[model samples]
Target: MQETPLCLRVGHFLPYSMSDLNTTDFTNPSTFILVGIPGLEAAHIWISIPFCAMYVIAVLGNFSILFIVRREPSLHGPMFYFLCMLAVTDLVMSTTTIPKMLSIFWFNSREISFSACLTQMYFIHCFSTMESGILVAMAFDRYVAICNPRRHSTILTNSVVAKIGLAVVLRSGILALPYPFLTRRWPYCRTNIIPHFCCGHIAVVKLACADIRINSYYGQFDLFSVIGMDVFFIAMSYTQILRAIFCLPTKDARLKTFGTCISHVCTILVLYIPELFFSLMYRFGHNVPLHFLVLIPSVFHPVPPVLHPIIYGVRTKQIRGRLLQLFTHKEI
Candidate 1:
C-alpha cells in the first residue's frame, strides 16, 4: 500500500482535517446568516410588500407628528412634548430593524458580520426598553393630569419632562449595554445561522456552544425589572385615573375626563399586548409551530410603530385639526 500522507495520518487521529481547521474558525465566526422565516421562505417577497408599506406609513406618520408638534405653538404642552418623544422612539425602533429585514426579503443579502449583528442587537433592545419607559412616563402624565389636576403643570414642568426623558434614555442604554458584551464573549462553535430576521438577543445567544445560563438568567432579570416595573406603575396610575373619572359629578364630565385617556390607553395596549405574547411564546412555546414563532416577532416589531401615530392623530383633537389644515391648506 502507498504511504499515507502526514496530513491524512494526523486527520485520522483528529476530529477535523488540517484543511478544515485552517478554513473554519469555530471560536469566532466571521459572519452570520439571517433567515426571514424558516418555513415561509417562499413567500418572502410577498410578505415584504406589506412590511414595506407599513414602514413607509410609519415613517410618514411619525415625521408628521414631529413636524406638527414642533410647528404648532398650541401643542407645546407637557403632553405634546411627551408625544414628540414617543414619536422619536417609534421612528428609531422601526428604522433599526425594518430596512435590514426588507433587504433580506428583497435581495437575499442575509450575511451580517459579527460586530454589525451585535450593533443591531443593541439598538433593537435599547429602544424597546426606552419605549417601555416612555410609556410609563406617559401613564404618569395622565395620572397627574386627571388625579391631581391642580399640580399637573407644576409637577410635570418643562424641566421635569426633560429629566424624565433623560432618565428613560439612561435606563434603556444601561440595561441594553450588557447584551452585546455578553453575546460577544461566547465561542460560536455551533452554526451561525439565526432563524429570525433581526439579531434578537436570545436567538443569537442560542448559537453559542458555551453554557448560556448566565445569559438566560440575566435576560429574564432585565425583562422583568424593566417591563414588569413599568406595567405595575402604569396600572397604578390608570387605577387612580379611573377612580377620579368615576368621582366626577356629571356624565359629560366623566366622558370628557376618560376621553383624554383613550389615546394613551390604546397606545399602551398596542405596545404591550403583542410584546407580552412574543415574550410568552419565546419562554413557554416549545411545542409552538415554527411559523408562529417567526410570525409573532415579525408582526410584533412593526405593528406598534404603525399604529401608535395613527392612534394619536385620530384620537387627539389638536393633532387631527393640524393634520386637516396640513392636507386642506386651510384652517380646520
Candidate 2:
C-alpha cells in the first residue's frame, strides 16, 4: 500500500491521484495530535497555572457539595438530590476535559488514540447535554415548591427523581451516539492535528476527507432538539414560577422565593454562555477565535462545576449551614 500526500486542510483538500486511494491501505489513522492553542506556542506554560487551578477548584468544590448533601438528612429532599446530581455531573464533565488539557499545556502530551478520542467526545457531550436536562428538572423542582407548595413533596419524591434522573441520562447517552459513529466512518486521509485540547465532535469531524453536509445538518438538528428544547422548557418553568411569585401578597415571601433560584440561574448562565458563544461562532463560519481555542475547553468548562457548588452553598440555607458546620467545627 502506497501512502499519498493527500490531506484535508482548512478551506481546501489537497488533490491526489485516484490510484493513490486505490493503492493505499485505507486503514483509519491510529492516533491524532492535539494542538493546544494553535498559535500560542510560547504561552502554553503561562496558561497552565490558572487552568490547573480551575480544575482543582472544580473537583474540590463539587465533591464538597456532594459530600455535604449526602451526609445531611434534612438536605435529602428533591431539590438537594437534584443538586447532588448536578455536582456529580459537573465533576465528570470538567474532569473529562481539563486533566488532558492541563497535560497538553504543561507537559505537551498531545497525542490521543483514535478510539479513546471518540470515547472522550461521547462522555463530554453526554454529560453536558445531561446537565441541561438536570437544570430543567431543578427548575421543575422550584416550580412545584413555589407554585404548588403542598404537592411539591408528592410530585418530586424519591421515585420521581429516580425516574427523571434515569430519563436525563438515557436521553444524553442515546443522542451522543450518532456523532462518534458518523465520525468513525469518515475517511481521514490527511494530517490528524486537532486544533483543540480535547476531541470535540466538530473539531474531529472537520478533519474528514468525505463530504460533511449531512453531518452538519444532523449536528444542527441534534443541538436544536436537545439543548434548544431544554432551554425553552427551562424558560417556561421560570416564567410560571415568576407569575406564581408575583401573585403572593407579601414582599418578604417573594424575596425569599427568588433567592432560592439565584444559584440555579447563575449555574445556567455559566454553562450556556460560553457554549452558545462557540456554537454560534461555528454555526455561522469556520474560523474560530484564538481565545475559544485556548480558553473554552480548559477554563470555561470548569466554571460551572466550580461555581455551582459555591452559589448553591452560599444561597441555600441548609447546604450553607451544613458546609459551615463541617468547616468550622472545633472538634475537627
Candidate 3:
C-alpha cells in the first residue's frame, strides 16, 4: 500500500487519504507518520492526570448506582431497569477509550494496529448507539408514567421491558456491525496514528486508500439517523409529558409527576446536548479544534451515568431510604 500524497492541507491537520480507505485493503504501507494534536507533550501533562481521575470516579459512580438498584427491591421497575442498562452502557463507554487514552498520554505511545483500531471503533459506535436507544426507551417509559399512569404497569411489564432491552441491544449491534466491516475492508495507505484516543470513524476512515464514498455516506447517514431519530422521539415524548403536566387537574399530581421525571430530564439533556453539538460540529464545523472536539464528548460521556444513580436515589425517597438501610445493615 502506497501512502496518499498530501495534496492540500486543512488547517494544520492533514487528512491521511482523501481517496478511498476501507477494510478490504490488506497491504501495509512502509511509512507510518504521526499526526494529530500539535503539542502532545503539553497535552499529556495538562490533560492526562485529570482525565485519569475522572475515569476512576466514573467507574465507581456507575458501579455504585448499579449496586443500589440491584439490592433495593423497591427500586425494581421500568425506570430502574432502564437506569441499570444505562449504567452498563456508561461502564462500557468510559472503559472503551479512557484507559488507552491515559496510556498514550502518559507514555507518549500513539501507535495502534489496524485490527485494534477497528475493534475500538466498533465498540465506540456500538455503545454510542446503545446509549441513544436506551434514552429513547426511557422517554417512552416516562411518557407512560405521566400521561397514562393508570396503565403504566400493564403497558411496561417485565416481558415488555425485556423486549425493549433486547431490541435496543440488537438494533445497536446491527447498526454498528457495518462500521467494522467498512473499516476492515479499506486498505491502509497512510500512517495509523489516530488523532483522538480511540479509533473514531472520522479518524480511521480518513486513512483509506480505496474509494470511501460508500463508507462515508453510510457513516454520516448512520450518525444522523440514529442520533436524529432518537432525539426527535425523546423530544416528542417530553413535549407530551409537559403538556400533560400542565393539564393535570390537581397541582400536587402535576408536581409529583414532574418531580419523578426531574432526574431523567437532567440526564437526558446532559447526555444529548454534547452529542448533538458533536454531531453538528463534525458534520459542518471544519475549524473545530481536535482537542475541543474530543474534550466535549469525553467530559459528557462519563457524567450522565455517574450522576444518574445519585440523582435518582437521593430524589426518590423510597429508593434513598432502602439504599441507606442497605448501608447501615452492612456496617452493622
Candidate 4:
C-alpha cells in the first residue's frame, strides 16, 4: 500500500472507543442543567404555573394601558405617549420568552433549535433595550413637565413624543443587533443546553467555540453603557424635578411633582438595582452560588413588565381612573 500522509492519519485518529465519536470531546455537556427552579420538580411545576399567570397579567395590564392611551382624548400627551410605548414594550418583552418557557415547563421539551434560540435571544435583548429607552424618555418628560411647566405643552407635544418614540425604537434596535449576529458567528463545540427559562446572554455565550473576548467586552460595555446612561439621565431629570418641587411657591405643585415621579422612581429602582447586582455577579461572582443564576436575571425578566403597570396604576390617579373606567363600562 502507498504510504499514508501523517496529516491523513491524524485526521482519522480515533481515541479508543465509539463513545468518543458520539460524545462532544471539546467540552462536557452534562454539567449544565436546564432546570428553571431548584430543589423540586413539583415546586418547579408550581413556580412555572405562577410565572405563566404573571405573563397573563402582564399582557392584559399592558393591553389595557395601550387601549386607554389610544382611545382617550385627554390622555393624548407626552406622558401617555411614553406610557403607551412602555406598554407595548412590556407586552413584547413578556411574549418573547414566556411561550418558550411555558412550553418547556409543561411538555418537558427543553431542546431549543439553533435558530429558535437565537431568535428568542434577539427579542429579549431588543425589548429590554426598548424598555430602558422608554424609561429614559419618561424621565426626560418628567423633567420638562416639572422644570418648565410653561413649555411642557410646547416642548412635549404629540409630534415631539412621536419623534422620541421613533428614536427609542431605532436606538434600541441598533444597539441590540450585534448580539444575535455575534452570537451566531461562533460555532458551538459542545452541548446546547441553556440554563434558565429563556435564551439569555450568559447562557448562550458559554457555548462558544471561538474566543469570546469581544463578546465579553461588548457585554460589559453594553451593560454599563445602557445602565449607566439610564442612571445618569434619570438622576439629572430627578434633580431638576426636585429642584423645581422644592423651589415651588405652592404646596400642591410640589406634592404633585413629587407624587408623579414617585411611580417612576419605584419602577426604576425595581428594574435597575437587581440588574446591577446581577451584572456584577455574572461578571465577577459567576463561581460563587448556583442560586445566583436563578436570582439575578429572573428579577429583571418577567417581573419588571408585570410590575410596571401595577405600580403606575396604583400610584398614578389618572392612569388608574382611566383603566378602571375602561373595564367597568359594559356594552350598551
Best by lDDT: 1
Question: What are the clashing pairs of model 2?
Answer: none
Clashes of 1: 0
Task: For candidate 3, write residues 1-332 as lDDT tens digits.
Answer: 22243212322453344243232334553322333343344666676777777788778767877787787677789988998898899889888878877776677665666667767888989988998899899999999998998999999999999999999999999999999788777767444444555677766666677777777788888988998899899989999999999998899988988998888787777777777777677555656666666566655656665666667777867667766777787531
lDDT at residue 293 of model 4 (Cα atoms): 60
- lDDT tens digits, residues 1-332, model 2? 11122123311221223243332344487887777766565688998888788778888888998898778788889998899889989989888888888888788887899999999989987998999999989988988998999998888889999999999999999988987898899888655767677898877777677787777788888877877898899999999999998998999989988988888898888878777776666555445554465455556667788888889888888878877789898332
TM-score of 4: 0.86
TM-score between candidate 2 and the true structure: 0.90
The true-versus-predicted C-alpha distance at residue 277 of model 1, in Å, is 1.4
- Candidate 3 vs candidate 4: the TM-score winner is 4
- Summarize candidate 1's per-residue lDDT along 72-183 as a digit string, tens digits: 9999888998889888989999998899999988998877899999999999889999999999999999999999999998999999999999999999999999999999
Backbone collisions counted per model: 0, 0, 13, 0
Model 3: how far residue 85 lies from native, Å: 0.4
Local error of candidate 3 at 329, Å? 5.4
Candidate with top TM-score is 1
Taking every candidate in turn, the Cα RMSD to the unseen true structure, in Å, is 7.4, 5.0, 4.8, 7.9
- For all predicted structures, in order, the TM-scores are 0.92, 0.90, 0.84, 0.86
lDDT of 2 at 38: 61
lDDT (C-alpha, whole model) for all candidates: 0.84, 0.79, 0.74, 0.73
Worst 10 residues of 2 by lDDT: 2-11
Error of 2 at 229 (Å): 1.1
